[model samples]
Target: MTAQANTALAAEILEVPHAEAAAVTRDSRPLRLITCGSVDDGKSTLIGRLLWDTKAVKEDQAATLRRDSGSQNDLGLPDFALLLDGLQAEREQGITIDVAYRYFATDRRSFIVADTPGHEQYTRNMATGASTADLAILLVDARAGLLEQTRRHATIASLMGIKQFVLAVNKFDLVAYDRAVFDQISTDFKALALSLGVRQVTAIPMSALKGENVVYSARSVIPWYEGPTLVETLELATLRSGQSTGFRLPVQRVSRPGESFRGYQGTVAGGAVKPGDSVAILPSGQVANVKQIVTFDLVRNAAVAGDAITLVLDRQVDVARGDMIVSLDAQPQTGLAFDAQIVALQPDGIVPGKRYWLKAGSRRQRVQVEPVQQLDLKSGKWQSADMLQMNAIGKVHLSFDETAIFDPYELNRGTGAFILIDPDTNNTVAGGMITAKRTELGGLNAHEGRVILSLPADLAEQLLATELLASRRDEVETRRVTTSAARQLLDDIDG
Candidate 1:
């Protein structure tokens, strides 16, 4: 096409009426979204275009961007990537290395966008961003199509429980706005999305640099395509609810204003609470009735998820920070062992039987992490793994020194997520989600309180020599037997 034809197409697309966009009337909470793709797939540019088209960028900021970018694209517009790649290292390297969060709003709704790094090494950061997102925008270059990183991001977002997906086939202009290429990529992504049990998928062809089909339509340029713009889809998308599970509030503080007042303070994590409701203090199993719900402004008769309030119980109980206040009828799982999926972030990765600090909600305790399997992103398979290296996603077992509380992540994300902190370095090493409480007998019968160990004689002797064991030698039973005798005993038990 000639330059005049390109200009005409652009004019037609721009002149298309905004009345075609979907209408969203209700006043809903802000929708959280994440942009992810392979390296240089235009994640930053997509966000920048959204901001610029929505007029979220100030004039002085735009001028500074123009000055700093120091060059204009062929479209005579400032480099949109400069708008979001704020870190000095990112600007210098021209690649996103960390998660950048930005906020913008349309006339219909508001949004919080997390632009995550696309490099495979920063996959942990991508997981961190996706954990809280209600929707995911998976961008792919039109020329490159669906790359391995694209599939990896999609899988992580789905596992993190993001049902809404928007496949932005970006840089369509570079491909001469070919509809067949767009359709092929969309069909391929749809198959992937279906495999992940995601039914809400919207695929759009867009040019983030030229601001096509982002906040506006590209109908004139790509006359064969018809769908909601990215912003329109986002505006119509529903917000994920925090009250999907039973009532829960992980105590963050205990407020005692004076002799007359005693309350537990925390943001309501799941479900709702009202006066006269029976509640329990977890890990302690202390039960009480809800007396009142107090906030900064006044006492409320009820409180729901997202509300920050102080709960006053009918009677005094042993409640403290890190303790969970939950509905007595629907108590959260409490056990010493749990199964979780994790993304290893540190260079050393997750070592088998390594003790680390686990923090969930406001609670922190020592835990031993054991890797069960690591995901093969390219093949979409789980392979047995003893240790998870950097950026590896794996399924693991967590054994805690003390009882831990959690709900399945699918039921309640806020109460089901945790982070692992390295004891020696004090750096966060992994993010994890509770899959289930490791139970025996399919949860039909309770677990025995005793632990049986089988070890070599030398190792057993070394373990028994530790100060901890030496102090409690009389507390636990010990036995010594030959391998043949041990085998015979096991055979007898089986018989």
Candidate 2:
């Protein structure tokens, strides 16, 4: 058979031979990414450029940009940053204050890019964006080099389990697009990333405003550089391989629109799922088989990592939004308590014994701050403390009212990340991840007390026996004589 015939046959088999109601095809996989950097570092501009240069932006949106071009302050060019400045405050302040989401696709892949705020005060926003991102793009200014904020952002990203990083040295035009400046920034950032436990770092030089080396290569400008452009790097980047040891799906919604169908919808947190796959409903541990996976129109026999679908079960099961569906073979963890490292972002310090809302994936539970360890950003040591201050990175012990499925932040990014919100104010004060468990009792005792306690039997005997033992013996004899005298006097009086 011809190659085209074989291709067509394979496509037909994928569409038909599989259960017509549930099919597995190649068109469903997508990469979820988050772009993070300090404010004014061109994160929004880069994303806007990526969309425009790739023709991902619609004609009407492009026309809007063209109409607003005359009002632009910078060179009277199309203000690409306008594409992401969704809020009035953001446009006025010229900074992204909250997390903004945008979707675009290429022929080979689709993307969900989260544009996060970058100010020191908005670290919680950055953490929220980074928690679910498979890849992180860290933008650096060529003129500024590696600032403290850059290091802090990278550290937070690494702590959030973002393994893949793309370091885009933006504003190359400001530095005259010098290769030396780019190399210096790249080397310095790489060293910082290595210390932060980042797995891979790819550095690319680009001018986001000028659209140099963004979607296409800037051969004329940077002839000395031989690597791929920012777009090319994203396109060629490898997807994370290896099946998840634990199967987890956080139930986002449950639907039973009619008698013909009943389904639970959620993004697959980890591992794989298929029709007939045995899954355990979390918080209850009831077992059932996946009957079918359904989306808006596409129903799939199987859904792997990152696929958002509705699952129909073989047996009637008690499942609800915020409850987790996990594989029986790889059961999800359930406990009312766990430990996490939280970066407190609110001005009011995190108080102990205060109830805060813990949001992990689609699950939210009431959790209390049991204890706050000291901020470690300065000394890199966990010290004892009662509360966490703004911009403070510290380890905390949190106790939830109910148990939920969780993975170590080191293992699964989707399952292991969480945030702390003030229950009364509904303000997110801290963002954290479960690093390790503080299982030992009296764990905080070691950090307290100015002097050490030593109860040595031999030492006690040496001091007390030599000084007080002899004196106490005479006093005991005197007390016994007085008691005998008192008894003799009482007998005489009775007689």
Candidate 3:
């Protein structure tokens, strides 16, 4: 397909599929990825091999690794996991405990790999890594085939919007390079990926410790198998993009650096914006035109998602930290109630109807979260639940005292995702994504409470005479006020 067609396909992937966010697009930026699987599945070894073969490892670091390992693996190489597992406890326990990020590059591409822990206890860390990744490398032992943890990791990656998956059937050498075993494992993983609604997948069989099929080809020993190496798959992978959604800039802060200059500063979270475009300050629903798009370097005609720029409005408006600046035509949803899915990250789990701080972008507000359903990994189903335990993935109901603005997570990851923090400890307890707004009040729109519409007096009367308006005439309260009064009301609501 053409590059333009590929770009369009990338945009399409970020949209809602099956009420869940599917594979998000990745672009020219460095690919962000995570290594995930069951414990002792060679995740770290795969990464170390990538770094080594790519020549990303320095002599000093390799020397340190050799000394720290005290012994070498059968390949006459220092313990490869040593290159990533840096913690003292991790080295002693021979397992990864925290998420370790490493940067490496090849002639064709650059990569930021998050080596996530394999144990169930550190599942939270894995989620953190998956949040920003464009692809996931799911490792599994060739002998063990697919395990519960393998399923869990794949599920979380899919939920986090990862579209591309690489199944690394590690330790093929230990399995005597069994072609049948590799074929079976790949077949099982393909079914799992298909169930997750992920169609972009490539499975490869290799021994990471022996450095076969990681950075190099595996056809030498496994003569029957023919496929690209692990490095080649990643090199061809894409990075996630936020430009598919309409223009959105979650105001980080109101910048008034000097008495003469004032602007709203923040990174563009979605779409693109330029001067002369009409924009809306949301939650307040105040409209303004983009007077200027300011940057430290110089002014530009346009800025797309991920660009950091200051916006100067033509006239003063009630915009503050947490308020969203978006294109008027493509406004996001504003509501008092929303539905979400979350992964409980703390041991305390999530208590129903408990108020916590919900932070999304630069916006932070108090929210009451109630668990609605918990995911059953074994059966791949969701069951009703009143509360969620640590490492539990569940759906929830969110109640806010004030207006909450969001796009469905599938439409825009930046504005649609959030985190819940424990008030007592200020610890982030859960990572979540918004599913949709709850419209509970009898056909009343989710973006309810108050609305201001301007129309000719005769046209308004003609509208009130309609059947729909006449049916709910008692519920409709009409008032007329000067433009000044309307502005004051909006400001009061914002406050």
Candidate 4:
């Protein structure tokens, strides 16, 4: 693409209402949340209520939902789940079969809620949603208390790095909104969550159908309950404050038009950027200076995390999509070998010696599964395994064909996560998180020698001729000895 077109694309992505620019920056850093539960546990209903009560739906859409209510036809509740259940089959089945993403904004924050399926068949889908989430909301039936599915969801969430959990005791109205029932469920879930290493657990008694304790506190029924409502607690929740520790922007596109302007465009994954900042382009180790920061309708002297802007460098540099722009001081390790935990979705197992495409950030590389260390779910202990089946969690060692920048998933979400794909089919097979890097023996100072050996053509010919002559001489000496023996025998006979 030309430089001008590239600059325009960047500007278009970054352009917003002046008031929205600041608001978007503050809220654009979304809180990824995943809802987990078993089928009929009201997972979909709770999500629908959260969106409806938050006033996220447009008036016309709400009117359509109201018009379409009262049928259990594929779409569960025509009013609430319709906002997220976009698929025809999902609407028909009245059950979520895959992960549904919904975006909404409140005065206090913006959220990307990942509504994951509850059935055992879609457990991998739930893991995919949970892997990138900061918090998890696990729904429990007030009548049933804690079920096996609840523990499984919580365990999966803990494994995926979700530290905060809210055990929402849903459908309290069925049990007459009893405080005793709510408290007992809360206590049971708390113990289970604690055992799973969940650091924070907040239990709330809610009735999604009744719209109680969801957006506003249900004053009449639960007068004794004084805790914050679901919306209020979410708004007050503390977010991680250390998101700006490293500089990382995966180049999405590169442009140079007639040599007038040349730069790269992508959303800032982390850290800050300013004029004269020294940045390195990954996989090539090329360095350049930030000459200017250009957006479509505005020019900025600096940009920070979440900003989408084109970076014009002082000198022409060879950069492209799949390359990372990083600060020199915080350059990530570049290599072919890395470690990751993969959650496989298909029934077809993931085996060693198989090649797959790995997409991490904006970089895509051809990767081979080197080995499967262990399956974490069945045994809860590490054991040797050959392949990962559906809904199976395993640690895999992967080797890439080219060098790529990466961070540990625990450290940086933007740089440390990736997806595995089948090269021939181009189907996404698994989602992975970089856990560690393979260390070479003898540290960084190890060395090996390189040399080549071959004989000259003339010398080779002469050696072959001399070997043939020696063989002929040996044959002649044997024949002469045989003739002498025969003559001696004849002389003895004549005597």
Query: Using lDDT as the measure, which candidate wins?
Result: 1
- Local accuracy of candidate 3 as per-residue lDDT tens digits, 56-78: 99999988877876756755677
What lDDT tens digits, residue by residue, belong to model 4 across residues 1-495?
332342343244334333354444355467878899877787777778888888888889888887867664443545567666778888888788879988877776888889998887788989988987888999999999988778778878876767788788888878988877877787787777765556477677888776788887987897756655777556544554326357788899886765688779998877888999999988899998889998888889898777899998888788989898888788776787887878886667576789998998777888998656554543244466787887877778888788868977666767878888888777788888777675554654234332221335565446435522222221122122344566675577668
| Cα-based lDDT at residue 196, candidate 2 | 58
Question: Scored by Cα lDDT, where does model 4 land?
Answer: 0.75
Write down the lDDT of every candidate, Cα atoms only.
0.87, 0.74, 0.85, 0.75
Name the better of 1 and 2 by TM-score.
1
lDDT of 2 by residue, 1-495 (tens): 232342243344333423532332333456768887766899999999888987888999999888865676566668888899889999889899888888877665577889988887887678778776778899998888877667777877776667788899999988887877877887787777765556477688898888898987877988766666776556544555325546678999989899887899888878888888888998988899888888888887788777888899998888888999988888755776677777777888688888888999888988888655664543334577877778676667777667756876666667777878898788888878776444435555335333222334566456444422321222222222354566676677669
Tens-place lDDT per residue, model 1, 1-495, is 333343344345433433443343544589999999999999999999999999999999899988886655667787888888989999999999889999999888889999999998889899999999999999999999999999999989987888899999999999999877887888899888877767778788999999999998989898766666898778767778877788999999999989999999999999999999999999999999999999999999899999999999999899989999999898889999998989998999998999999999899999999998888888776788999998899989899899999998878898999999999999999999998888755564255456556678999999977533442343457789998887787777669
Runs of candidate 2 exceeding 4 Å displacement: 1-28, 66-76, 238-243, 250-267, 274-303, 306-325, 343-349, 357-366, 374-384, 390-392, 401-404, 425-431, 437-495
| Candidate 3 TM-score, C-alpha based | 0.83
- TM-score of every candidate: 0.84, 0.71, 0.83, 0.76
Model 1 lDDT, residue 171, Cα = 95
446: Cα error in model 2, Å: 10
Clashes (N, CA, C under 3 Å) per candidate: 0, 0, 4, 4
The order by descending TM-score is 1, 3, 4, 2
Q: Give the poorly placed runs of model 4, Cα more than 4 Å off.
A: 1-30, 58-68, 71-88, 91-93, 195-197, 238-244, 371-383, 442-495
- Badly placed stretches (over 4 Å) of model 3 are 1-28, 443-495
**Clashing residue pairs, candidate 4?**
11-296, 74-91, 74-92, 75-91
What lDDT does model 2 reach? 0.74
Q: Rank the candidates by lDDT, best first.
A: 1, 3, 4, 2
